[model samples]
Target: MGITDDAKDALSATGEKISRAVDDAREKVSDKVDEAQADAKVKHAEAERDATKAKNDYKEELRDHN
Candidate 1:
């Protein structure tokens, strides 16, 4: 009975540690996903600005040609 109780206690502790590790990993992955999303948004905005500038410059060139 003593050995059985000790084994049960050890199992419980090990289970708790595993659960904590899994939760920590989930939080880290979520944070990385958020960071990636923010980085993508910034890149998208920069690309849009560059595209607009190019379109305006093309229009100016066309006007000069006319």
Candidate 2:
């Protein structure tokens, strides 16, 4: 038989198992994406805070110099 026929037969035999596997894979990928997004947001916020602090400090130093 051709590959399509073989695949169909395999799906017929293991449809539920295959479906569960696909769902699990999708959930894992989604979780990883969400985790990465959250991490990026945290880093961005931290960088902004640090930049603001540095700018304020530099302004103070410049005023002292002047």
Candidate 3:
């Protein structure tokens, strides 16, 4: 089945948040992307965790709204 409007919005917002985090991580690491690859990886992993939480929260919200 297709996702609900609310679910889509939630997912999009979560993605945007992750993208921003990735950008911030890149900026913080600075100058040499290769040297800072490890930090970038960690930041992406944390963002993934955050995205998972966001999805769960959205699922609960959908349940409540329904």
Q: Best by TM-score, which number?
A: 1
**Best of the candidates, lDDT:** 1
Residue lDDT tens for model 2, 1-66: 699999998888798888899999999999999999999999999999999999999999999999
Rank candidates by TM-score, best first. 1, 2, 3
Please give the RMSD to the true structure for each candidate, in Å: 2.0, 6.0, 28.3
- Candidate 3 lDDT over 17-40, as tens digits, reads 999999988887685776588788
TM-score of 3: 0.43
The alpha-carbon lDDT assigned to residue 7 of candidate 1 equals 100
What does candidate 1's lDDT look like per residue over 1-66, in tens digits?
A: 999999999999999999999999999999999999999999999999999999999999999999
- Name the 10 consecutive residues with the lowest summed lDDT in model 3: 27-36
